[model samples]
Each structure stands twice: as structure tokens, then as C-alpha cells.
Target: MSLSKDKGEQNPLEKALAAYIEALQTKPVLTKAVTSGCISAIGSLVSQLIVPNPANGGKIVWRSVAAYAAFGFVVSGPLIHKFYILLDKMMPPKKEKTALDGIKRVVVDRLVFAPPFLLLFLYVITILEGQGHQAAIARIRESFFPVLKLNLQVWTVFQYVNVNYVPPKYRVLFGNALALIWSVFVASKRRKMALANK
Candidate 1:
């Protein structure tokens, strides 16, 4: 009966999903930003669910979720996408001689971008939650090293494969997919810290 789609044709859901992925491929920055916000919001929701909260009838901390999602959409996603583009432009990825180039990309990414990004994420979350400047500084001071250590351990190895194997256009997508787990980890830590402080 259907001329456009045969019986064996993709279902509507699959077609919609395929179209969405294709759109993401076309617009890397916006797609990644939207993905970041969604993943971060999911992470925050999970964190609140898992972390113990006896106060406020245990409802989800919608404010934290909103703040993190907003930051991820506005800052982390676009910034990292642009950062990876710049890195690739500066140090073109080599297909054959990947060992050295991969190492260089990893080093530069970890040293230059990771530190500042982590700091900014923590500070932004703290500030958005209306924490004072002094409290924000204290939160950064308390959390920075631990988060950085985890970041180094995780991203160093991950970026090696990413830089060497992944194509430039898909790099941000790859990174953001992996960042979903990292989002949960960071959100959990933030929840713990907030509870401790309270």
C-alpha cells in the first residue's frame, strides 16, 4: 500500500533517529551542545536520585540540574567542539604516523584545556547555585585536584584513541558520548560535596 516506504523499509522510529543523526552530522556545534545539555541534565537527575537527601521530601534538585544543563549546552559542548577543531587545525592528525601526533594532541589537550575546563565547570556550577565568591573558591580548591586526577586517568587514554583513530568531523560526537559517564561521575561528586557542606 505504501509506495514511499516498502514493507521492509525502516520503521518510523528508525527513520526519525536516522534523520536526527544525519542532522547532527551536518551541524556539529549545535548538535554537540544540545547533546551536552541533555546528557548533563540526565547526569544531574541520576546524581540526585542516587545521592542521599533527607531534606525537601527527596525531590530532585531541579536547580542543580538546570544549571548544569545550561552550562553544558552553552559552554562545555561548543567550547570543546571548537577546541578540538583548533587542535586538529594546529596539529593535523596523521593517519600513518599516529603515535607521535596522538601523543602530542593528548598532551596539549590535557595540559591546556582540561585544567581550565574543569575549573570553569566547578566554578560555574557553584556560582550558578548562588554560592559566594569565597565559597566558590573553596569548592574549587577542594575539588580541583581530585577531579583533575580522575580526568587525567580517563581522558589521557581515551584521547589517544580519539586523536589517532577518529575523524575530525566525528571527534566531538565521540568525546561527548564518552563524556556522559564522566558527567555522572562529576555530578555525583558535586552532590556529595554539597551534602557535606550543608
Candidate 2:
């Protein structure tokens, strides 16, 4: 049993996972921020690869990747970690939480949290890209409602599962995993809009 346990610990994948879990427990906010930043950077890279920008002669924009990563690290991850904690406090789980509890959590998340977050995301990205206040306003005017509509369609379901099923500690990680794809979509949309505006 000792030999087998040692071998299991020696497995690199398992070791890495264990370390990540430890980090999550020991430093939840920082760990989530780093994870979100890395994932966001990768998502930006994937978007660039999938839809090469003609403006930069089809070159990858390193700055944009950095901006996305910064947004994830500074804004998304920490906020989400706290938000999940807040949600749990707002709807403290009983031994037998009803479906209504989950529904209310989802409703609050979708209606209260998402709209301002989306707006902030659009506004921040534009500013990070060196665009002016007017440009950020224009981006919001052009993109907010359409993006919010899609966000409702997609995230309502995701939030239900997240709030109801996922553990609070893992909630940000769960959301960040899905947000990888979301980041790609947002990046592509932002790029398209930038080109359109220019």
C-alpha cells in the first residue's frame, strides 16, 4: 500500500493537481487570479489564431493578450471569488436546499451581477486598448445589448449549475473554465467592432 501510494504521488499530473488544490485552499484569490489570467491569455491567443487580424498584417497582437490577461487577473478573478462567497452568504445552504434557492441565486446573478460586469468588461477593454472614453461609450452602445442578450441565453443555464451544484471554493474556477470560451467570443467581437469603427 505504501509503495502504491508513493507511486501515485510520483505521478506528475496528480502532483500538479494536488499542488493546485493546495494553492486554491491556501490562497484562493491569488490562485484564481493567476488561473484566470493564464486562461484569458490563452483565449486571446486562440481568438487571434482563429480569426487573424488584417489590420496588423495578420500578426498576433501581444498587447491585446496582455490586456485580457490583466483584466482577468485584476478584475474578473478576484471579483468572482468574492461574488461566489457573497452568493453563498446571501443564500446560505440548508441541509436540503430547495430548487427555489438555486433559482433565486441564478436570478440575482443574471439580473444584478452580469449586466454591470459585462458593461465594465467592454469599457475596460476599450480603455486598455488605448481607446478614449468616447470610443468606450461607442463600444458599449454597439455591443452591450447584443452581448448581454447572448450572455443571458448562455450563462443563465451555466449559473444555475454553478450556483446549485458547484462548491463555493471551486466556483470561480468553474466559471473561469467556461469563460475561456467566452473570452474568445468577446475578443473576436471586440476586434470586429474596432475594425468597424475605424
> Which lDDT values do the candidates have, in the order given?
0.81, 0.86
- What does candidate 1 score in Cα RMSD to the true structure? 4.5
Q: Write the per-residue lDDT of candidate 2 for residues 41-106, one digit (tens) a residue.
A: 898888888678887888998888898899999999999888888988988766688889878989
Q: For residue 131, what is the lDDT in candidate 2?
A: 82
Every model's TM-score:
0.82, 0.88
TM-score of 1: 0.82
Which residue pairs does candidate 1 place in steric collision?
none
Give lDDT tens digits, candidate 1, residues 37-141: 887788778767767467877788788889888988999889988998899889887657756767898899899899999999999988877776888899999
Model 1 / residue 7 / CA error / Å: 12
- Please give the distance, in angstroms, between residue 158's alpha carbon in candidate 2 and its true position after superposition: 0.9
lDDT of 1 at 131: 78
The whole-model C-alpha lDDT of candidate 2 against the native structure comes to 0.86
* Alpha-carbon shift of residue 189 in model 2 (angstroms): 11
